[model samples]
Target: MAGSENSKCRGLRWALIGSVTLNLLVAGVIVGGFVAHDRHPPRPVVGDVSLGAFTEALSPEDRDALRRAAQKRVGDFRDMRQAARTDMTALIAALQADPWNRAEVEQILARHKARTIDRVDIGEALIFERLEEMTPEERRAFAERLLKGAQRFDKRLDRDDNRPPRP
Candidate 1:
């Protein structure tokens, strides 16, 4: 009987130890997540549109300048975004109509495309203005960074192509 009791006590002790260790491990994970999150705050969305790798290659000052310029025209950006959303909703409705209307769908698509082009034009103008402000040397440096970024992108694409298909 004493041996049985001793074994039961050992089992309980082990279970208690395991529970404490598990709780500590969970606590450690939560703390680590918070620390990691604080280490890298989110990047700001410039003009609510990605300018692609060209924007990525810009110098910090130039990027900030461009961001400020975009902000000044925030109203236009907001309107364009709202129009885009409306267009999508309309397109979906048109797609679901009982009697399909190809002309209506095409009209919505054309409007969407025009809005997209307008947004791109605005972004391009902002970029061009920023470039104009830079000295020749600064522009050359920007070009070099742009080229390097493109090369890196191409290498990544090549690597992805060589990867085996996922199971």
Candidate 2:
């Protein structure tokens, strides 16, 4: 009778241990799947448009100015991003070298603060201006469609920060 009771106690302990181990394994698998999904999600398919056709509607000089401004903005944004990457790399290395590397981190953050990049909503402005030129009924219809698209776009933007601007 004592032997039987001892055996039952050992069996219960083994069952509890097994259950705990299985739970941990399942949790690990779920976490790994989430990380993998985030690392390699499907790329979006972007359609191409003609630059010539896009600029055809504007005056020659205005079109040229717009093109130049767009180029400058893109270049500025790229330079800032490059600088940010460099700063982050240095900060990471510094922190790894000494966990309390506050000075280096602060210096990098200061540079980021000084290099302020302004985001332009040029496309949004252009769309609004063009819509304003249309007749009231036409404008209302265009606005309705635009609102629907903007809502969808906002939702997508919320999910993926790198979505391209619509033409």
Candidate 3:
């Protein structure tokens, strides 16, 4: 009976030792994690959910310069749009001339295609980058289709706009 008692005492001692060791290990990990976090708190990135960092990154002078540059770019784009409108007007006149000029029609189509590609490529790159689930080939095909569709739409509009106004 005493031998059995001794074995029971031994088992209880081992159990207590194991429980204390496990508790210490858990406590140590928690304390270590806290210390590490304090030592290396994450630095905020500019424009990453923190407007303060983004504002801080820009100097007042730089911001002013950026604003001016942005205005200039807008103006340049407006000029391009106006130029396109003028070309379209000339195209309409050429097509309406007593003898339809095939060369003028082709030239107008080419200019429209170039402008359409410029705008479409920007959208294509954005869509390709943002679509997380598409495979590379699928993304490429989608971008191609997008560009073609934009060009076709621009061509159709150009043709319709050039037609004579109803009396």
* lDDT scores of the candidates, listed in order: 0.78, 0.55, 0.56
Model 1 / residue 20 / CA error / Å: 52
Backbone clash pairs for candidate 3 read none
**lDDT, candidate 1, 109-158, per-residue tens:** 68866987998898899889988999999999999999999999999999
**Which residue pairs show backbone clashes in model 2?**
none
Give me the candidate number with maximum TM-score: 1
Q: Model 2, range 93-124, lDDT digits (tens) per residue?
A: 76567454657756865775666423234444
lDDT of 3 by residue, 1-167 (tens): 99999999799668645644553565567568667887887532211111222223333543343344344445544665666666666666765688867578668657766776764553344333334445677456656756666677799999999999999
Q: What local lDDT does model 2 show for residue 18? A: 67
Per-residue lDDT of 32 in model 1:
80
RMSD, every candidate, angstroms:
20.0, 18.1, 36.4
- Which of the predicted structures, 1 or 2, would earn the higher TM-score when compared with the native? 1
Worst-scoring 10-residue span by lDDT in model 3: 44-53
List the lowest-lDDT window of 10 residues for candidate 2. 44-53
> Comparing 1 and 2 by lDDT, which wins?
1
Descending-lDDT candidate ranking? 1, 3, 2
Ranking of all predicted structures according to TM-score, beginning with the best and ending with the worst: 1, 2, 3
